[model samples]
Target: MTSQIAAGLLICLCATAWRMMRSLPAWLRLATGAVLLAGLTAAVVQMVGSPLQPVFVATGAAAVVWEQVVVAAWWLLAARLLVEVLRSTLFNRGLAAKGRLQGDLLAGLIYLAAVLTVVDTVLDLPIRALLATSGVIAIVLGLALQSTLADVFSGIAVGIERPFNIGDRVWLEGPIEGVVDQVNWRSVRIRTDGGDIATVPHSVAAKSRVINRSVPTPQRSDSVRIPCAASVPPERVAELVRHALLLSPRILAQPQPAVALVRIGRRSNEYEIGFAVASSNDLWHAKSTLLEQVLRQFRSAGVETADRPGGGATSEPDPASGSRRFLAIPLFHDIADDQRERLCRQALSRSLEPGDALFRQGDTEGSLFFVASGVMEVTRTVGARSSSLGRIGAGDYIGEIGLLTGAPHAATITALTPSDVLELRKEHLAPLLAETPHLMHAFEASARRGQALFDRRVAASVGAETVPPGQLLARIRDYFRVHHVRPGPDAHAARRHPAAQANSPPGGD
Candidate 1:
């Protein structure tokens, strides 16, 4: 009765553990099995402590059969536990392939040995004949599963060599560019950029050339070709393009982007902009951002590309060009057409080479600047600490607070690329505000919004509280010396341009 209870408990534990195979870690399950095995051994010892009676000889045979059955179960459980430990070790050492192909093969051999030992010793079977028949069956199965066995063996090789681990971004000869999601016995699974899972058979993958982009380094290098008219000097084109490449925040600057006149044609010259990004995932965004900056840079420098209808730089600046540029600004959008033209005409255009500083952090210059083209970086210094606030691009304006309320520039503005800034002094804007006193309120609100955005981008915890809304309006009135006029509910709404939102600094909100 004692042995029977022990065997029943052991069976129950095994069943419970097997059911929870996926839920429980292999080491935990192995520990549970080991405890049960120890308990079973104790129970067996207790059963053996008592001697059998002579009158119960017939019953003794039945008892022996029951003991054999229990011992056989113990051997099978031990074999499984051993396999679990080995599998765990293999995974820890990175020796196990995805899906445990090598571990599974080893487990099969261990299980086969356990079964053979049980048949020979526990069940008392004819071992020699069984072995001979099993050899023949193994041969037949091997022949039938030739391709499957090839994959299994190839997977084992992959486990040992470890060409690329799961989650590594790899490129195959099939022009397959994607991340490695899984490596099962039969195939390697790749998740493409388009979110499709592609399965390549292990046999085929073994033969194909693979490039592991994730290994060594994750940075990927790419280039864009811009064609300019043969009339434009390559040196000028190269300098403009190099500055444009540097303007993009996505493109890495450490390796230093390269610009070269790679191809020359009778009608046009093609320059290649070579740059590297943090990863292949950033390639598209970096390329697009660089191209946009290049277009802005070329336009600002009066350079023309081959694709443009005129094939050469504008010989003379248009009279209305300044007005057109100013009209695009949201603050000047609502002003009368005549007012905009006069203001733009009076505005002074300042050209800055790369790394030029428009103003330093503590500059008290009470002036507004509009980004005509190219990109500029905004940085602020508070005491001993200096940090980048963000970047401002074309169609964006800066120095609003300084221009409106005579507030000192809170941040330093510097040219990241070849930039053209249109500087507007108080005298230039005075007439417009004089005619429309309500424009004071619009200017105040825009400045407030920009300051709030700058504060948040710096960090919420360290951000300083902005000036009160009414106080800012009052300050603007005092600075401009204009009488207060009630602004309409939607006075600022009609002045907003859709493109301004996208082209604004990082803190567009």
Candidate 2:
């Protein structure tokens, strides 16, 4: 009866150990299996023979085997129990949930403490003397791992300070700039915008000056400078450049752009066009665009750029480029080449700054502006709220009816970037169309198409009533005063008159 009971107990223990094998770590699983095997063998020997019996005593193999079994059960069982406790109670909590439990510093410390406890309790080993010698051992280890210790301490400091988090963009004093991808024990790994991975030692990174571009705010303030002849009025330069920058889509709309006369010399005046963008990534592009549009406007207005030291030299683009762009417009496509050329010659080129309004809703100005480059956003205001109506870019023109028919603009056109527009003002447009009656058909068709586009976007925005192209044409003719031709000379002679040129440069120059 006693032998059968020992055999039954061994079978029960083995079944329990087998059930838990998958949950154990590899070392723990081996320990558990070794311990259970020893326990089973002890139980089997107990059940198979009587102790100190004649046959059992002769060989004494069972006694030696039992001593080994006892040692294995003592150590391995303690290790398995401790491991289970550590995994279930500690690892499964907050750290495990975040997938960072493995190799965690605090957890490793806990494991060491548990191992010491098991050594003292289960092995019956007194470890107080070992604790006393630990200081000497630590000193030897410290000297061998001097660099590693520095990195570890630095990493700890970084964790506590939390200067930057994973995924934050940082520019370091070491000329390294990238987005932080991981923060490890000894180093930080970052992925640069160019797609290169950089590993920075924690000790160096901790000591370096760092700019966290992603923190506080990602918006970047930037400026573009243009040197203008001092003879040009400061107000004129500011107004022209401000309008030009308002056209850029990259620029921010608020905190309104400011132009400062930063430096003034006998030969040249330095004007800084200060503005902000939604992101630092756009800053360089925004500066490039502002410079291009501002310079183009100054050149077209005959406002010569003053040459200065360190101010990059200016290059004037081909004069024929503007005329060629003018000819590409649908309204000018049907108009005779000579008529288009005269119109282009008389047209005033304006630079528009981002968020600058070309014309407001219900504007009565009879002017057509064509987007030579950059973008324009058309918006409609109902009471105090505004909704986007549509947008236009290079090769697109706005205010056709206002230019050809003298009609009030139904929507407001705001610049989305530093933009250039060839403006055919009332003085330029009225006389041109009056002399060239055949151009009216193209004008009507173009006006209708533009109105259709406006109405289509308007319908999406507000679902308001739509206007047919015929009604749009009638409105255009009335506003342009095309019906009653106020006889003025062709655009060429009127524009060439010396008196007009003198008055023009005061504002136009």
Candidate 3:
């Protein structure tokens, strides 16, 4: 009867294990339960059926030890696998979905408890005595490991609060800046931009002053300092700095930009050009580009940036006086002084009140206009739908696209308020470009660059709604599974291809 009951129990356990294996992927579900059942059966048979037999007692004791080993191994392996899989899935879902280390710790504890329960049952241990002994040992260990315990508890608190996560750019109290590399039970890892890894204890990190550039938003504020001779007017310096920053594609428009006289050095007045960036990840790239553009503009204008150590002090040139005051416009800088003067004379200065229409959509591309002051609204009409592309402010040039390509005006340009514009007629621009072939190339290059900028903005707006490529591919794979599509010849071929197989590292046989 005992043999028959054991066989029945074994059959039932195997059938349950098979069902579980079929339900979950092999990698996700461990067969610990089946192993535990087999061990329990052997233990029961040895202990109850042949209690006084020395061989049965020895066999049961061995089986009990083996069961404990299996349980511990399974618990550790399953816990590790579960944490890794959950972390990966959650992280890929979104920034908000990332799992905290506290959850992982909790999973580990639960696995430990489950393994202990199995071992206690298999060995027929007295739970009350074991609990009493464990309590006494814990008390002694806790006193000896006060600091370690603090760190562990602090780690749990930090994980729960989540001041920052992996990939976050953070500046700690010591003003240490780095990207978060890892968050573990007792310490946090950060990778500094200088290519060094920083390991900060959780106890310190939990209470340290931290500035997370990736939290709230990834945007960061950056500043570019441009020094000028003390004599240059502050207002003029601010205007120049503002114009340069606005033209760059990388700089954000909202929150606008700020320019201030930061300091007065011994030889020069330093002005700080400050702007906000969309991401700290791209901060270096944006700063480099803005500085490059600013330098280019200053050089083109023939503006002296600073006084040399030995050179005599040079006073700022007056914009109103006859003394040559350079304008930083790219087009103006390209032409010769005499030609520029002629072009300036030929250009018409037009003023329009608010609500005035400068040019309607479909109008002939007759002339290009540069905004001298005030704002102009550029609106496009497609059938009944009308969209405002953007507003152009002072120092911004427009209508260049139509004038260059001879295409009809793509949008209507209307004055948002009283505005002044410098109109360069196509006829006047033609002769000047014809006289100077190199000038044509400069104008075309600038125009092309402007068009590319416009296209990028349009693309960014359109692409914002699209899903990431990886996510889309995952969804497609899931869809195939749901539809029960049989793997085709092409699928088999893809899997069997050398290129596909090459994704995994080569192994030496």
Query: Which has the greatest TM-score?
Result: 1
True-structure Cα RMSD, model 1: 6.9
Q: Give the lDDT ranking, best first.
A: 1, 2, 3
Note the clash tally of each candidate: 0, 24, 0
lDDT of 3 by residue, 1-509 (tens): 35434544554564466566556664444344445444544644443442212122235556545434433343434444455455445534543333246556656776776556644644457888988999999999999998888888988888778788778889987667899887776788889989999988889888899888887888788888888866556776665566567545568987788989989977679988889889876788778867765664454334568867777343332222211221234444444555555556666778899899888887864576766654567777889999976566554565654555454667777886666667777676666544333344445444445444642343122112222323432332232222323446643453344233223322211
Instruction: List model 2 lDDT by residue over 1-509, tens digit each.
Output: 46435545655675587586776575666566666656655654554342212122223665544433333343444445555555566656533432231336765665576557545643446798777789789999999999988988888887777788766778888798878887778888888878999988889988999888877887778777788977778887776676567545578877578889999988789998889888767878888767876765675445678855554323333445765775565565455545566666777788889889888877767777766666677788889998876565554566665665555567787887777777777776666555544345556665555556632343222212233445655555565566733325643344334233222211120
Residue range with the least summed lDDT across 10 consecutive positions in model 3: 317-326
How does each model score on lDDT?
A: 0.71, 0.63, 0.59
lDDT, candidate 3, at 177: 89
lDDT of 3 at 179: 90
What local lDDT does model 2 show for residue 376?
76
Between prediction 2 and prediction 3, the one with superior lDDT is 2
Candidate 2, which segments miss by more than 4 Å at Cα? Answer: 1-103, 254-256, 307-337, 341-377, 380-386, 389-396, 399-509
What lDDT does candidate 2 reach at residue 296?
58
TM-score of each: 0.80, 0.55, 0.55
